[model samples]
Target: MLNKTASRSFYLNLWLGLVGLVVGIFAGFAVGISPALLLVAIVAVAGLIWFFASFEQAVIGLLILRSSLDLFSAQQLPAAFAIALNALTILYVLVALLTGKAVKIDKFWWFFALWIIFQSLWVILLPLGGLGMDASFLMSGVRVWLRYFSWLMVYLLVMQLKDNVPPEKIVSMLLLSLVAPISIALLQIFLPSSMLPSLLTSQGKAGSNVSGTLGFPNGLGIFLTMFIALVWWKLSISSKRLPWLLLLGLVSFVFVRTGYFTGLVAVLLLILFINSTKITPVRAIGVVLFCCAFLWMFASTEFGQQRLTEIYDTPLLNPNIDVSRSIILSYGDSNSFNWRIAHWTYLINAWSQFPILGYGLDTSPLLGIRDFNTGSGYAPHNDYIRFLVEQGVVGLTGFLCFLVGQGWYLVHLLRNSQSVNSRRNLCLILIALFVANIVSMLTSNIMDATTFFFYWWTLVAIAGWGNEYWRPNLATKSA
Candidate 1:
C-alpha cells in the first residue's frame, strides 16, 4: 500500500512538472515578446530537448530552421536563433566528451580555427601599414568573424552528430526543406507579380528572373544548382526515377532563367561529368547532334536571342591591338563585367602592397576602392581575390588548406566507404556540390553569401556523418 502511494505521487508530480513548463512558456509568450522571437525560443527549447532525446530530430529541426531563414529577410530575424544553435553545439560537445564518444576532429577544422584566430588578432592589433582601423571597421570585422564562427560551429556540430543520424534522413530533411523554396520559385515564374509577395518577386533586370524566397536570383541559382545535383544523383540510384528527373528538369529550367552564367556553366559541367563514364562513340555522336539541335532551337527563341546578343555585344575581341591586351582592356569602366574586372584589379593591386598578411578582414572596401559614381566602397565579387586583398597570403593559405583538406576527406570517403548505395550516391552529390561551389565562387563572393555557405557546410557535415555511421557493418546501417 505504501509502494502504490509513492508511485501515485511520482506520476502526479511528473504530470504537474510538464504542465507547469507549458504554462511558463505560454506566460512568456503572453508577456509581449515579438512573435518571431517567441517562435524561435519555442523552437530552440524544443530543439534542445530533442537534441538530448534524439540526435536525428535535433538535426532535422536545425535544417528546417536553416532553410526557412532564406524566405525572410535575414536582418529581421532575432540573434537568439544563432545563440541557441551555438549553445546546443557547445553542450553537445561537452556531453560527447563526458560520455567518451569517439569524436573525430578533422584537421581542416584546426586550419579554419587558426584562420579565424589570425583574423581576430589582426583586427585587434590593427598593425602598421594596414588599412586604417576605425570603430566602425573594427565592429564590421568582428561581425564577420562572428558569422564565420557561427557557421563553423554548425559544421562542428554536424561532425559530432554524424554518427548519430542516418545519411538518408539528412538527405530527406534537406529535400523536404527545399520543397517550399522550390514551389515558391516555380510559382513566381508562372504567376503574375501581383499574385506574389513583394519579397518573392523577381528583382533581376528582366522580369523573367525569379529569386523565389531566397531574395536574390543568383543565390536562388546557386541553391538550385546544388539541389539539382542532389536530385539528379538521387534519381540515378532510385527505381522511382521519373518524378525526380522531372523535378530536376524543372529546376534546371529555373536555373537558366536566373541568367547566372557561372552557375549554369557549373551545372552543365556537373552533368557532363556525371555522364562521362557512359559515353560511347555512338552516344557521343548522338550527344553532339542533340546539342546542335538544342542550340538551333534555342536561337529561335526571343529569350535565347537576347541572351546571345548580350554575350556577343560585349567587346570580347578586338582586331586593332594585341589580342591579349585588347581583351584585357576591352571592358569599359561603366560595364558590369568591367566593374568586376576593376574590382579584381584593385584587389590585386592592394594585395601586392601587403603580400603576406593583406589589409585584414573586412578592410578591402575601406582601402580607397570606391565606386566612382556612388563613391561607396565595394567588395570584390570574387572570394579568392577578396581573400587575397583582405587576409593576404597567410589567410589565403589557411583557407586553401581547409578547402584542400575537405576535398581530400571527401575523396577518401568515396574510395573507402562500403556503405549502402544510397550513402554512396550522397557521397557523389557532395563531390559534385564542391565542384559547383568552386566554379560559382569564381564569379561571386560565395563565402559571404550566408545561405549558400550554410547549406554547403551542412551538406559537408551530413557527408561526414555518413562516412562515420552509415557504413554497412554499423548497427544503424539498416536505418
Candidate 2:
C-alpha cells in the first residue's frame, strides 16, 4: 500500500536529518570550534534516530517536544524544522505499517483520516483555483493541516504501545514533561519582564500575563486546563498527594493569570461533572452557590473586570433583537475584545452567499475584512463562525462530529466502565476535559491553536490506556 510519494518521503527526512548532523559536526571540527549547542544537536539527532527505531520512544519523545518547545514560536525555530517533526512522524507510521508492525487501529480513526484528507484537499484546491494562496498563507495552513494528522498518529501510537507499557508510566512521563512549560511560566512571574525575550513574554510586562512557553496566554490557559484535570486525577491515585496538590494550586493561579475566563469556566464544569454520579437537588443548589462565589472572586482579577463589565453591559442578549451596534458591542469595542461582535456579524452575513458549501477550508480569513481604526485583519475569533463561513455547513457538521463523537465514546466508556479503580480516574478526567474544551472553543481560535490541540489529542490518546473498556467493537461488545 506504500505509494511512490510515501516511499520516497519515507526515509528522506531521516537520511536528510542524519546528513545535516554530520555536515554540522565536520564544519565545527574543521573550524576547531565546536560549541555546547553542537553537542546538544548531536544528542538530539541520536534521540531522533532512537525514536525512529521505537514507536514507544517516538510517542514519549513527542510528549517532551510538545511540552518543552514552542511549537509556533517564529524566533526559536525554522518553519521547516517544526513541520519536519510531525511530517517525519507520519512517515514513520507509514514505515511501521510497511514493516508489518502488528497493531489494530480503531475503525473510527480511519474514517477520521479520510475526512481530514478530503477537507485538506478541499481547502488547497479551492485556493489554488481561486485566490491563489501566497507562500505565507500556504505554509501557515499546511502546519494546521498536519496537526490534524498528528492527532491521529499520537492516538494510534499510544494504542499500540499500551500493551507493553504501564499507562501510569506513560502518564507520569507526560506529567513530568510539564516541567519546562511550568518553569518558563514561573520565570515570567518572579523574574523582571525586561529579563525575558519579548516573544517569551508576549504580555509585555511578565507579571501582567503568564504566556508560558506556549507564547500566548489564551492558548496557554487552555493547555493548563488539561493539566489541571489530569493533575486532579494524579492527586486521586498518588500516595504522595502533597506534590500533586501543590502542582494543582500553582497551575490554577497561572491559569487565572492567563486571563482566559473561558478556560476557567471549563475547569469549573469539569469539577461539576466529576460529581455527576452523586449529584442531588441539594448538591445542585450548592453548585449554583459555589459558582456564584467563584465568579465573584474571578471578577476581581484585571481581565475578569473587563469580562464582567461586558456581561453586565448586556445582561442577556435577546435572540429576537438585533444589537449589532448596541451598548454591549460598544463596550467591547475599546478593549482586548476589539469589536468581535461586528466582526462575527460581518462574517456571518458574508457567509450567507455560500451557506451550504462555504468559501473553502482556511479561506474564511481571505475575505479581506479589516478593522477601520487598527487597519488590521482579525482572525475569526469564533471557530464555529469560521467553519461556517469558510467550510460552510458541511465542514461545520464534520467538525462537530469529531468533537461530539469523542465525547460520545468517553461517555459510553464511563457508563459501562469496569471495576478497575485506576480506569475510573482516567475516565473522569478525560471526559471532564473533552466537554470542557468544547466550551472553551466558542470564544477563542481552538482549531488554529497548535499547542492546545497537540496536547488535547495526546490526552485523548492516553486517556484510554490500560483500560479494558477501550477495545474496538469488533473485538468485544464491552469490557
Candidate 3:
C-alpha cells in the first residue's frame, strides 16, 4: 500500500510540475521582463521540481529563500509568479500535515491553533459582512489570512530539526542564509542607482538607508535584529566566541548600513536590560558607552536628522480637532507617525461597523479607502489597529491572552534558568523582543510581516522544542 501511495504521489507531482513550468514560462514571457528575470523563472521552476519531490527539501528550500522572497515580492516579480509560489508553498505544507505527519504541539500550539481558526472563518464570511466581495479585495484578504500558515509551516519544520539535525548544522545553514541578504545590502550601498534594477531598489537617497533583500529598510531592520540576537546567543554559549567574530561583524555592518532604526532602537533597549542578567558592571558600562557612540554617529546622518527633527501635527488624541487623514498629510513635513495616526483613525471608524468579527483579514487597506486620495488604501501600520480592524474584538482578545501566556512562560524560563548559557541567553533575547514588540507593534506590522517573522518564529520554535527537551532539567532546578 505504501509503495502504491508513493507511486501515485510521484505521478501527481510530476503532472503538477509540468503545468507549473508551462505557467511559469508564460508568466516570464508575458511580462517581457529582462532576460535575467527569465533565467530566474527557469531556476524557480527547477527549484519547485525539487520541492515537490521531497517534503524535507521543500521545507529547507523555503528557509533558504526566506530573505529573497521578501525582496522579490509582487513589486519585483510578476504577481502571478509570486502568488503561484506562495500558493504552492501553502498547498505542500498543508498536505504534508494532513497526511498524518506529526509536528510539535504543546500549550503554545493551542494558542496558535485557536487564533488561526478564526482567520479562515473571516475569509469565508467577509463578503457577507460587506467587506471583501470584490474579487481583488477578497483575494487579498484570503492571501493575508493564509499568510499565517506559512509561518506555521516554518515553526513546525524548525521544530522537527531539533532532534534530527545538529546545532552546528543549523548554524551553518543560517550562515549560508546570510549571504544573499548581506550581498544585496552591499550592492545597495556601493553601486550607483543606474547600476541596480528598480525592483532591487527603493526611493532612498544614494548614501543612506537602502532596503536590502527584505525590500524595505524596516524589514531589513527586523531580520537583522533577530539574526543578531541569534548570533549573540550562539556566542554567549560558545567557549570560543572568536570563530563567530567575522560573521557577527558582517551582520552588524549590513545592519548599521541599512539605517533602519526600528531594530536598533529595540536592541539598544535590550542592551540596557541585560544588566539584570548579572553581567559584570564594567561590561555593562562598556555596552552603554558603545550604544552612546553609535547613537552619536546615527544622529549625525542626514536621514537621521530628518527623522529626529520632524514633528507630529496630531497629538495621540484630542476631543476637538480636525485630524483627518488629508489634514494630517497636508503638512509638507508631516511625520510618518502622524500618517499612521490618520490612517488608523479611518480604519477604526470603518471597523466600528463590524466590531464583532471585523470586516475581514487584510481588508484594512481597502477599508481605509476613504483616507487615500488615490483610491488605494494603506496598511494600518499598527498591529493593534490591524487586529482590531480585521480580526475584531474576539481575535484581539485571543491574541492578548496568547501574548500574556508567552511572556509569562519566558519569565518562568529565565527565573529558573539551568546551567545552559545558550538557553538562558535565548530566553533573555526572546523576553526583550517580547517587550520591544509590545512597543513596536503599536506602530509596525508585527503579526503578518511574513519574511521577517518566518525567521523570527523559526528561532522561537527552537526555544519551544528546547522547552520540552529540557523539561526534566528545568523541573529539577525549580525543585
Best by TM-score: 2
Give per-model TM-scores.
0.77, 0.79, 0.76
Report the error of model 2 at residue 166, Å.
Answer: 1.1
RMSD of 3: 6.2
Candidate 1, 253-308: lDDT as tens digits: 66666656567567667666555646678656744553454345445546555656
TM-score of 2: 0.79
Sort by TM-score, best first. 2, 1, 3
Which structure is stronger by lDDT: 2 or 3? Answer: 2
Per-residue lDDT for 145-191 in model 2, tens only? 76676666656666666576666667667777677778888887678
Q: Which has the better lDDT: candidate 1, or candidate 2? A: 2
For model 1, which pairs clash?
Answer: 162-465
lDDT of 3 by residue, 145-184 (tens): 6677656655655665556654434544664667787888
Scored against the true structure, residue 358 in model 2 reaches a CA lDDT of 71
Which residue pairs come into collision in candidate 3? none
lDDT of 1 at 126: 53
Candidate 3: minimum summed lDDT over ten consecutive residues — where? 470-479
**Which segments of candidate 1 are over 4 A away from where they belong?**
1-47, 78-80, 98-108, 111-115, 127-132, 202-207, 278-308, 313-335, 366-375, 418-420, 465-468, 471-479
Q: After superposition, how far is residue 348 of candidate 3 from its true place, in Å?
A: 2.3
- lDDT score of model 1? 0.65
Residue 302 lDDT, candidate 3, scale 0-100: 74
Error of 3 at 30 (Å): 18
Q: How much is the lDDT of residue 229 in candidate 3?
A: 65
